[model samples]
Target: MKRATSIVALALAALISVYALFLRPKENSIPSPSPELLAAARPLDTYDFDLVLHPDSNQLGVTMHACFQNRWSETLPDIVLRTWAGAYASPETSPAASDELYNRCYPNGFSEGGFVLHDVTINEQRVTPTFDDAAHTVLRLPVTNFEPGQWCEVSLRMVLTVPDCLHRFGRSQGVWLLGNCLPILSVYEQGAWRTDAYAAIGDPFVSAVANYNLTLSLPERYTPFTSGIFEHANGLYTTTLHAVREAALLVYEQSVTASIQADGTRIVCIGRNKQQAHKPLQIAKEVLKYYNQTYGAYPYPVLMVAAVPFAFAGMEYPGMIWVGENLYGQGLDDALELTVAHEIAHQWFYALVGSDQFRHPWQDEALCEHAMLHYVRARHGAGAYDALARLRIAAPMQENIREGITPGSPIDSFHDLEEYTTVVYGRGAAMLQALDVHTNGRVDDFLKEYVRRHAFALASRQDFEITLADVLKEDMRELLIDYLDTSM
Candidate 1:
């Protein structure tokens, strides 16, 4: 009897070990946020998505559930969403169709891709949504009475075809880039929804702060780099993002990754190999540390920098940034470091303090460019900062002023990417530099105060001017007019 009992106990122990080895779920690699952070996020809108990837068909099946509250004073007539992926459905309307971006975006030539809405539901009842524009980027859902302070739930079933291109929202070199692919709630201001067109010139996305819960399933070999803290269980990956403007994910077969801690925030870098990953990881760590000390503490818990097949130097989302794969190659060390610093600055300028990128593209872009100067000054020296300022900002602005392009002009006012970058990024930074001189180099203090005031809210051009004036305790109208409004 004793022998038999021991045998049964040993068998049970073996079964438990097997379960631990194969059946038990993997723990979260990232640490949980503080309770205060979690509590602060509870009041924002919530988005939940269940996504499945089909590599064979180059498709993704998505089911989205979102809850939004009417925080506005007046009642709303309908809900508007920006279906940005729909812009890829036709070459005629696609942003990649431009002569400058065509070859670089579609390396193997363009293949058809876009969102196909299967069904939609509002308040648990089936509803029809209207495509309000030619590109089908703006979707409107009618409601009888969306009263103020009322909450609404929206559900959508859709499929996305991954385009065979090297762009941010396409597939390249067996990797899938999912930047701004989700249909998100449109920003409503002044008694109307912002239904901006998907322009090719600059980053045209503008959104409010929200929380996201994403559940993703992919093929056995593929892994996803997401813009949130995530864990894996039962063949599914779940992510949680708090108070972010948008979420981005990059899917690939494999990657070399490294992580470092910066003021309690986990900074992860992903690349095709160790050589590609290590340098960027170190650069990100330094940049984040500098920004935290200079401006304020980073709000999010995790920040990821992933190398992707993209034409641009880098693209910024809420918690994740995509660094162009080419920038990781040999002899581009300065470019890689500068790009990393620029994108990391966006975490404060764009992610933490929201802005209308479509209308005032300079707000975030120019701030980020100037932040790069600060980082250079702190890390290298004042001489390095001045050289970068002269080469990147002063020279470019002089040439752009020749064309009479105002740095604060609307995105549509620029005809192409060159003009857009020259004015918005170059001259815009020049404007801030001028302000720095006028205020006796108090721009850093002003930025710190600005972030404190508009941490998770959208700030318009007027808000920016007001904040600067308040910080300096002086009138800035003439200075702003000379730099931003009047060209040269």
Candidate 2:
């Protein structure tokens, strides 16, 4: 009897060991970040979110607990948050309401969508939040006697009505995009809060990096592709993203996936089927390899690319990117490759090296375009690079110059998407190309140094100029003025 009991105990111990080693969650197996990266991410704000998606009702219920420290020298009064999804509540406020976007965004006509705030608490004390705009996109919460270096905890409960549209923050065909839907803390700079309106042109967003802990519950059939490494267990999906401007998720009913590793970073591509996902996955792997060699290593552990019903060619997030679903069809091979390369470049330019994309759209957009040129030169040869430069950059830029349109103009300065793309993407890239010529093709080296200096910090126009001057050992004020200050 004693021997039989000992044998049963031994079998139970082995079964427990097997489960711990092999059947445990995948997130537990993820490698830890470098000590330097961890130290840089420790001081920023942190958000804990519990999200429940009701696909049948087209709504998302969220409970958020945000802890943020006042980093400024002097701080009092209130904290502000940007409820970007409110911009979709009506046609007048929607960025996609423009004539060029309305039809593409709302194939089934307009559907109202916005956040319905239920309650708010600061340090466990109940408080009421106020809306600073008619659209209710800017929310302010009054805090009592908050001081610098002191941390504040905010809790919120809200429900978001997902719009039926093809744009970001909406549902289209069986896929739902939850981009910029959460109420994110607003930027406070130079002794005041930056309450920039949601402009109808360009990507009108400016934010600082924050750590995110998110748990999402979706319907049984739904699968989510999110911004960070995630694991599934007991019908719940959990994710953790460190040092990202925002967390984005794309939920779909079904997907065919492909994955590859480039320089220790895993790249996953998801589409409706294998035919649509394989090519982009290969392109993403190639681009990641090139950028890692050219600039620096990608900061994140995993990068996800998903085919979405987006109006644009692609959209960039911290650890994820959305490729347009339409581009998956045949005869659009060039478009697909270019889009993948450009968005991957954003991982370096926009994600790792932070900037105010709203105020200085050229900072990231133009740099990505410039990086794309180098990628073309390396992968497709010098002849292909030259042809692409002439067709995409030089021609459109010349036209913008002829029209007296400045590439350095803010998003509000442009009347429509066409003009904004022509100036910011085309002409702005031309300015960088000119810099490459002036520096004897040393712009790549300059950018590598820039990324090293500003990784995980926000950079300004002045900062960029100073970094370039330091890299080249000569002042570039005159050349920058020629392109940024004057149209000619």
Residue 141, model 1: Cα distance from true site in angstroms? 0.6
Q: For residues 84-122, could you state the per-residue lDDT of candidate 1 as single tens digits?
A: 889998888788877888988887787888988988998
Candidate 2 similarity to native, TM-score = 0.93
Q: Return the lDDT, model 2, position 67.
A: 99
lDDT tens string, model 2, 97-191?
77879998888899899888998999999998999998788999999978999999999999999999888889987889999889899999887
lDDT of 1 at 77: 84
Q: State the C-alpha lDDT per candidate.
A: 0.88, 0.87
- Mark the 10 consecutive residues where model 2 has the least summed lDDT: 23-32
Give the C-alpha miss distance for residue 222 in model 2, angstroms. 0.4
Backbone clash tally (model 2): 0
Cα deviation of 59, candidate 2, in Å: 0.2
TM-score of each: 0.93, 0.93
